[model samples]
Target: MLRKTESSIIFIQQLGRGLRKHADKEFVTIIDFIGNYKNNYLIPIALSGDKSLNKDTIRRMMKDTSYINGVSTINFEEIAREQIYKSITNNNLTELRKLKEAYHELKNRMGHRPTMHDFITNESIDPIVIVKPHKCYYQFLKRINEDISELTSYEQQVLTMLSLEILDGKRIHEIILLELLFQNDQVAYDDYVTTLEQLNCRTDSNTLSSVIRVMDLTFFVAAQRKNYGDTPICNLKDGAFHLNDDIRRSFDTNETFKDMFLMSYYVQRKKQEPMIVALH
Candidate 1:
């Protein structure tokens, strides 16, 4: 019996079978059969990451409905956990160059990192050839300088929590709390509360407030409103807690991120309501 390969590239390779470009067709269709086996649970683990494969992990992953459509789940707790992968030798240089070019070209085309499967579907290479090199996904992203591997473990956990799967699993209040972390890193306190209330989950405001405090200790830090003697200075007046300006800038710029952020912050602050702005 032909079974599905968990490798993202494998899916892409198979899609290559009879795949053709049609500008009129906006979607590609896949037909897969989920077999009856104790080892079926492991596929979720592979799709997830290097983390342990267990019932909870798979459950959370399946919550992400944003992945592929129409895929259903079995009773994960009842299924036996089995690791079903083998070691493969690295892909030759020619193969590596192909990968680099495919990814880079996609980045240029998409204006962001290309999903592995997208590369397989679009590139005219066999999916088997892509996976033969045995490189981990994280290794490939780092090689191309599009970084996700550098994320702190806390960030990864938050990402997992805020992912479409887990967010879809939780209550509306919980979803609002996580959405605070969308495109912008920081937001205002009132906006957090207001967004949560949009769904009429009024019971969560106090709890959500507490969760923000906990997230500050572990996943993020907050900037408090402060004072210089009697004068009010830089502080969060219900603003969102985020990676300080410096850290945020450091991710993209080489100039001392923290220092630059501070300088810029002060410059902008002074200019905002100033009759005259200067620094000594």
Candidate 2:
């Protein structure tokens, strides 16, 4: 039998086959793709891509519960190709042809594989989970998602970003912002303004508004606009958001930021689904 990770990759390949066909046909060359993965679900994102496939659209599409499940990423194209070819070589020719067509569609839509930066940002990872033989991997993943629904999209984004920062030790805003922007270099004042608008945050200026919303009183001290000559400028709390002892300490010590929310999400999920274990 394939490993859990391999099964996840296969499932993603299947889903990508369907999505890639309808996706816009263009090579979205980006500095990075801010992909988020939880359990088996991999949300591959292209920041500032075609307007229709922008961040907001991707977020909304992912909110659809159906597509949110059984998603994963395979970062190695050759590995993906090898897997596909090996599977097809021994399978029925008709099914092989169909799989090939879908594989081509995915290749055309998403290009090759994701970069190393992509894995770090979204916390897309392979963490081992202990389970009984009867308990399928997808079932375990679904349970994990069910345990974390109280988290808003903004909150989830913040958590994932924080997770990455913590994993990387320390990260800069310009670097983070650029990673978030991914494919686009020409960021304007409006980009900041729009992110704030989506989150319904209030602030004195566009410069610090989006930053304020992202930090959400959980991790940052402040984001403020200051004048730099004739142009508007903003400073993020410190030089950059540090993920060393201070930040990690906060997550461990603070209730509102981590433990309380996690407990609530987990407890409520368990209470509502008492028979889930038996069902599994």
Candidate 3:
């Protein structure tokens, strides 16, 4: 089909007409010209009937056409694949309407509100992206008018910090240390190093200290620090690290916030890999 279509349903409908049986018709050759379009990523989603909305899944589908079943085959030129990859990477999946649609779709499927873990497990848009435009997921929900509990200012601040700094899963040291503190309330510095060693993560002093600085907001510039209220989530004492008392109390009292925070960690844990440090 030579027609350009933005909607997967319309694209499939157009292709379906050409696949219909006809008298004396042996085989049909379909050629789709992929121009410089931003929605080129939808080609695989339409072909595979996949609604995961994950870029990696779409890329894998492009690489392997075996999912089509039977003797039918599909192929893409190298340049076309590159174009689709660019489209997938450059398209903003976190647009407000798109986010709302993804949220409600999952919510309807599960018969209740979906958590960050739900989004991760469903292979929907990354939860980190969902929380990007707002202060946190809670704020996003509020923007969509979902029924959610009200958050105190402190609770909002903590969630905002977690969303902005740690939810991306880029560097996971802060997540590891925070999880340790949540489990034990306090963790010795030596024990923390031992934990990293056991996990095969980098245990150098510089890396370890940087983790603490990030959690305590010392790693950020002043302008960036203002976004998180210029407060530390953890404290370093003589020989150990401790979760801030107010944050700890909030974690204990606010089950919703605790669930969201732990859900973020769970999602990151699935995406986490051992940190590789170079020796100079």
Candidate 4:
């Protein structure tokens, strides 16, 4: 018989492999296999990021659910107890106390059932390139001098502006412009034009579209566009132009790079969000 920890780890490794096989993308998330949460017993972990319990972890403890869709019935209580046990076994005294305190601190917080993290463990692919581009990235933007550097002055400005706007994922051109001004709101075309002028980039919608098109053609960026609201939005992919601190650090440190690389790859895979194309 396998030890509980060993059993749970095996389950996790299995699920990890399953996710990799199921999804075209390398990174995996709870959302991919969450069609039937309660029956599947993957709900809590998907919702919460608690490290204690997760679907695979629970699966190991219970080994009951049929990984089939259209199941006829389920013994919810039995699985629920398995989830509760995992939560109890996984945590230390301090966390247990916190869980209990949180239970009473807010009435119905537990919702007559085990909490989210109690049922599932929250796992994520770590970041790839860890870059603190704010300083060096922006310094390249501060000076407008044209001839004395590696990246052209134009490229530097655009890259800095892009870094400042997006924290985790990519956005379309209009969305990027909108963020620079209204930040998640609508901005008059005039204000947007002024901002672009100040940056030495053209404000015309057509020119901006061309810039994106050219970048994609050159492999300087990879983007996927989708419709959002009444407008189209574009998002960047984990391609060459994108720079991440975690990824950069991994490459710099010979010893830690492999592990960090996997983690960063995971982060990039997880962060992909749906976006609309930029319509000129």
Candidate 4, 1-280: lDDT as tens digits: 1222223344455555635544456544332332222233333332232333323444443444443335222234554556555554554422334333433333244344222222221232111111222212223223322122243333333333333323233433333342442222234445556655654545576776554443333323323111101111222243212233332333344432333223222232233322221222
lDDT of 3: 0.80
Best by TM-score: 3
3 or 4, greater by TM-score: 3
lDDT of 1 by residue, 1-280 (tens): 1555645456445656635668886555544444543334445544444222223434555555243444433232322222221111121323566567756766788787654344434543322233324223333455557655354333222232222122223334333443344346766767767764554445455676645543343322222111101111112334654543433444465332223223222322222323222111
| Model 2 lDDT per residue over 1-280, tens place | 1223323355445444545633565432212122222221122222112112122333343333243234433242444334433443343322324323433443355565322232223233211110111022222223434232243333333333433322222213233343333333234545654544454444356536545443433234333111101111122333332222333344555543454223212322333233433433
The full ranking of all candidates by lDDT, starting with the best, is 3, 1, 4, 2
Best-to-worst order by TM-score is 3, 1, 4, 2
RMSD of every candidate to native, in Å, equals: 15.0, 21.2, 4.7, 19.5
What are the Cα lDDT values of the candidates?
0.40, 0.32, 0.80, 0.34
Candidate 4 overall lDDT versus native: 0.34
Clashing pairs in 2: 42-71
Error of 4 at 103 (Å): 35
Q: What TM-score does candidate 2 reach?
A: 0.18
Tens digit per residue, CA lDDT, model 3, 14-66: 88887898998877777888874579988998899876566667788988888
